[model samples]
Target: MASLPEGALMQRAAAGLAYAVIGHLRGRGLGGVYGKRVVLLVGSGDNGGDALYAGAILARRGVQVEAWLLADRAHSGGVAALRAAGGGVVKLSEGYRSLSGSQPSVVVDGIVGIGGKPGLRPDAEEALAMLAGVPVVSVDTPSGVCVDTGEIDGAHVTADLTVTFGSHKPCHLLDPAASACGTVQLVDIGLRLPKPVIESLEAADVADLVPRPAPDGHKYTRGVVGLRVGSATYPGAALLAVSGANTGLAGMVRYVGTASEWVKRHNPEVVGDGQAQAWVVGSGSADGANSALAFARASGVPLVIDADSLRALNGPLGVPAILTPHAGELAALIREDRGDVEARPLHYARLAAKRFDAVVLLKGRRTTIASPDPDTPVRVNTTGTSWLATAGSGDVLGGLIGSLLAAGLAPIDAASAGAWLHGTAATLASAGGPVTASGVAAAIPAVIRSLPAVSS
Candidate 1:
């Protein structure tokens, strides 16, 4: 929750960059910039000004600095300072040849900032092609990435290191563009932007949000989670989901399915069928529509709709609920409700949340959680690894969230906290290798323990 005033934040960012550059040089065993060569690709915005001003600092330190202006308009004061500090400027043109043979030690990309358009300008593209293979550092965000949407249109610069001001933007956390951003370094710039349009949950943040057991708390007080999943054909789903809920987060788990034998075999503690505070419905229960619908009408518990259950829904689901859908499922939902919803995830998530009057957790590389009210801030989960894409993982996630909901966390908090824990557990279990659904479930306790302490 730490923040800084707008202008002061920018200055701090510049200072951080100065220190980083100095450190990089020192680590390379270079005495100083007295004889090193640096090239800067300058644009027309504050991004250019940042690089220009930083260049002035390097110029004073004896680095031979050259600024290649890509736009007719440039940062006036920054250019003046660089020139006064003995830096030279040149208008970028086709006359420049390949720098592959004599590449500068470093290149600064200042083409676009946060206000950049979706694609690069013509001249910017040509300049980048000319400087191919040069080690470059991007300011703010990589030029040409969809700053607000995290979408990459056409092409964008791939930086060796990105010096971002303030906190990370969506593009730095989401994929495609995220992959393009190499080692990101945050610079404290003094800008106080509004609450972020998106946010990544950190360990400390999760620690504060997760609930703890009290001395007086009992199994019933902790709350019961009803699970309506699995079938004769795919009983494994029931076991996996139940295993995921066994992390001591839920007081009791109740099973309702034809796969009761399998569920009991795996988790004998589960009740045969009973009332519950929350329900995890559908995971490998393809033919369980009848039972699911019956449970839906009979159970007053908050529900998590997933996999087959999402497809089985017929009318307005009459209860507090959360829908967990990936791109394909979301696309299908959009087709059923709104035509172009999937094209814009934020819009679709908000719309779905409102239409269903329930919390919606849209699963993806960067999971997004939205509430029924548009004004409420959306939560983005950032703790995942690609290993989470394994089969049966979604079922585990459903049970974990259902457990939190049963434990009395609000729908939004339950979904978001469950997602954060699921992702963190996946990362810990994977250890940079392939992991099974059971591994992720097993790691939940460790992840919970790693969270910062909070009194019940």
Candidate 2:
């Protein structure tokens, strides 16, 4: 399957792109591409060819098409086809000021495709600078972005909508590049690429991954999540994490720390101490690393390591662990290994996964989940809002993942499901308003119930 031919793939991708651009324009009250002006920024590869062919179709529809050749050499066949269809290449010196006055409704950025290096060439950058104010639709991955790693090196284009081919690439899902790709629409090119290098979790995917309790299942049968968190100094973190875990998603919760009494007071169903199918270590346990490590080592099940527990990852964790780190903590982890997290998140996440021999969940605006195996496609969680970044949100996320692990999902599944559910719950709780950590926890059951039921 990996050996599928490329020529056939490019043709299908180009055709799909044409249809998508036409449909998008039509949807915006521009019926038929009749009087619209489209500028295609052509490069030196099949990507430029895709744009040239797409320009040919638009020209045939009576649309005024102009191809701005950025490369010294352009796609020969594509350029010929565009000229045959009445389109002409304009000199780059026409300056963006002149083009902005034309007010072209849509600009097609075909400057570079997936084969591009980290940043744009000086010439490419100069051309892009001219089109700054115009609305752009990027073909394939956004230009100047690390397609495989999802990093934006030097300068990159911010697209109004990115039309991706086949499956989604890492750049479409991982931040800060994901933020640049405004709205992503996948074009089915019928090319069976190898299993995706990275994947984003959708609502339906989360529904399928979240385990449902059996009708005859008891609390113990549902699987227990042991949480070792909270201290005299920061007791609220433990409370918030436990509050999230008690959303009727887990069979039972067991608290193991000095703040066990505090957790027991809020939710009496929690056991003082017992065996657990999963463990949630690190939260408000600022100085409680020893307790977190002890609990994690003893639990023999999947673990969700977050906040302070992340600092305790020096020793052998033994169980299937998921490390949740924000940019700061992640940067620290990267610093320990002489790497940079912000420069390349995907690379760092993958490295951490292998080094720890566990699943790694890097949290940010876009939460990324990666396993130790490089071939395993990273899962990005997209269903979140800016309000979800409020304080204590990470603790809630840890509890949710711990619940999934207790429900028997594997470490990766648990992390992905938890992130998805956490985002969904935040959306529901927000309802166009601000939401607190407690509100997010209260919204989990509704989010879970809203999921599409699985069919036999």
**In each prediction, how many residue pairs overlap at the backbone (N, C-alpha, C within less than 3 A)?**
8, 0
List runs of model 1 lying over 4 Å from the truth: 1-10, 21-36, 61-64, 98-101, 314-316, 336-343
Which number leads on TM-score? 2
Q: How well does candidate 2 match the true structure in TM-score terms?
A: 0.92
Model 2: per-residue Cα lDDT over 72-164, one tens digit each? 899887888889999877656653545755767678889999989878888778887776787788899789898888888788888888899
Q: Please give, for residues 1-456, the per-residue lDDT of candidate 1 as tens digits.
A: 254454444445556665666556665686776777778899998888888888888888888878899888898877988899999877886226434445677788889999998789888888888878767788888898887776677878988888898788878866557767777788765556778767777877778777677789999999898888888887888888888877889899988888888778878898877788988887888888557856765777788888887776544577889989876787686565433443356666776788778898988777878898667778878778998999889989999998999998988989999999999999999999999999999999999988887654
The lDDT of each candidate is 0.80, 0.82
Off by over 4 Å in 2: 1-11, 23-33, 94-101, 334-339
- Count of backbone collisions within predicted model 1: 8
Q: Which whole-number lDDT from 0 to 100 does residue 120 have in model 1?
A: 90
